[model samples]
Target: MIVGLTGGIGSGKTTVLNFFKAFQNISVYIADEEAKNLMNSSPLLKSQLINAFGKELFVDNTLQRAYLSNLVFKDPKKLQILNEIVHPQVAKHFSEFVALNAHKAYILYENAILFETQNNQFCDCILTVSAPLEDRISRIIHRDQTTRRAVLDRMQHQFPEEKKRLQSNYLIQNTSLPALKEEVYRIHNILTL
Candidate 1:
């Protein structure tokens, strides 16, 4: 079975993903990391990004992430256009990854925008990690070394927690790592059953 794991920014999704990685016979595909690699390496993506943004968006043939982030965060339409260019490639990469692991009992497709892109529909089950807004903002501020306003601004772009929670088959509240690990094991058992 394929499970789609998702959460808003700073929602402790990565921590839970790590917990899953500890188990046997499970494969994890992280879409954001794959997308970043594709943006930097794919000739098609490179030319398209340069055309859509500008030459300055690349430095040493690699994407200038800060510049791209600023561009997309400032304009929602540009973000959509960027997603248009990248999501399909990421999806294709995911399909290949899934095929490679077809014999496994379980695989995870981890993405921050799983619900946003309706990719959750492809999963056998959906898991949404969540944390209180204040905690999430604090985590992002410390982890990204960004201002509260900036973190909150990014969070505003995500689907609300209540809405995402409603769409998920399981909700993992990540207030503490030990508790979260216990929840992960519980979910693993349930899925294997």
Candidate 2:
């Protein structure tokens, strides 16, 4: 089964993914991380980005991530356009990943915007991780060294936690590591069965 693992910024999806990784039968695909890799390594993607955004977005054959992040997070249209450019390639890559991992009992495809991108339709089930808004803001501020305002701005682009939770097959409230590990194990057992 392909399980879509998703959450908003700073909601601890990565932590949950790590817990899932401990299971021998589970294979993981991190969409956002793979998108970053594709953006840098794929010539076709590089040309598309430069054509749409500008050549300056890529400096010395590397994407100017800070510049791109600042631009996209500040503008919804730009963010949408960027997603348009990257998501299809990621989806194709993800399909290949699933085929390669077909021997596994479960494949966890993790993305922050799984619902937003309509990728949930491709999933057998979705697990949405959530945390209190204040906790999420604090986590992003510390991890990314960005201000609360900046984190909030990024969060604005995602569907509300409540909406995601309502749509998901499973929900994990991530407040503490011990509790989270317990929850992950519980869910893992259910998914594997």
Candidate 3:
């Protein structure tokens, strides 16, 4: 089985994903992290990014993520364009990863935009992690060290938590760490069985 795990910004997707990773029969693939790795390692992606944004976005062969985040987050269209470039490549990579891990009892495909990109179509089921709006905003502010306004701006680009929860096959509420871990383990058992 392929489980597509997703959440809005600061929804603790990584924390939940780590729990899923503990299962001996499950393999996890994180699209965002893989995309970051590819951005630097793949010459084709590098050229596309430089062409779409600019040469200066990469310094010393490294993608200047902070600068790009500042640029794209402020402009919705620019952020969409960036996603357009990265999401397809990430999707292709995900297919390969899943194929390679086909022998496993299940594989977790974790991507923030699973539904938006229709990546969930590849999964047997989809799980979304959710938190209160205030909690999510505060988490992003602390994690990204950005202003609350900036965090809200970024959140606006993501699918709303309530809507995503409705669309998901399963929802994990992440107010408490123990409860979150239990939710993950519970879901893992269901998926594996």
Candidate 4:
């Protein structure tokens, strides 16, 4: 089985991922990390990004992330274009990763934009991690050392919790670590059964 684990930024999805990581026979594909690497390494992605955002978007043949981020996040159209260029490559890489782990009992695909990209369609089930907005913002601030407004800006781009919750097969409230672990183990038991 394949499960898609997702939540908005700062929703503690990574914490849930860590719990899932503890389980044996499970392979985890972290789409964001993979995409970041691809963006920096793939010649095709490099050419496309430069075409979309200009050569200044790269420095020393590496992604000028700060420049590109300010450009994309400031314009919804630019962000969409960027996603269009990168998500397909990321999806292709994910397919390969999935094939490599097909022998496993199950695999987990963790992505912040699972719903947005419709990647959840590829999963047997979807798990959405959720937390109160204030708590999420605080967590992002503490973890990323990003300003509240910047965190909120990124969060606003993701699907709302209500919508994601409605689509999810499992909803894990991430307000507390102990409770979160219990919830994860419960879900693991259910899946294994």
Model 1 lDDT-worst window of ten: 149-158
lDDT order of candidates, best first? 2, 1, 4, 3
Q: Residue 30 of model 1: what lDDT?
A: 95
lDDT of 1 by residue, 69-128 (tens): 889987999999999999999999999999999988789899998988889888999999
Off-target runs (Cα >4 Å) in candidate 1 are: none
Question: lDDT of all predictions, in order shown?
Answer: 0.92, 0.93, 0.88, 0.91
On residues 120-161, what C-alpha lDDT tens digit does candidate 2 reach at each position? 999999999999889899999999999988998999999999
Candidate 4, run of 10 with poorest lDDT: 65-74
TM-score ranking of the models: 1, 2, 3, 4
TM-score (C-alpha, index-matched) for candidate 2: 0.97
* TM-score against truth, every candidate: 0.98, 0.97, 0.96, 0.95
Error of 2 at 38 (Å): 0.4
Please state the error at residue 125 of candidate 4 in Å: 0.3
Error of 1 at 136 (Å): 0.4
Candidate 4 lDDT over residue span 1-193, tens digit each = 8999999888899899999999997899999889889999999999999999999988999888778877887789999999999999998999999999998878889999899999989999999999999998998899877798888888878999999999999999997899999999999888878
Question: How many Å off is the CA of 57 in candidate 2?
Answer: 1.4
Deviation in Å, model 4, residue 96 alpha carbon: 0.9
Query: Which of the numbered candidates is closest to the native, going by highest lDDT?
Result: 2
In model 4, what is the error at residue 83, expressed in angstroms? 0.9
- Displacement of residue 80 (Cα, Å) in model 1 is 0.8
Cα RMSD for candidate 4? 1.2
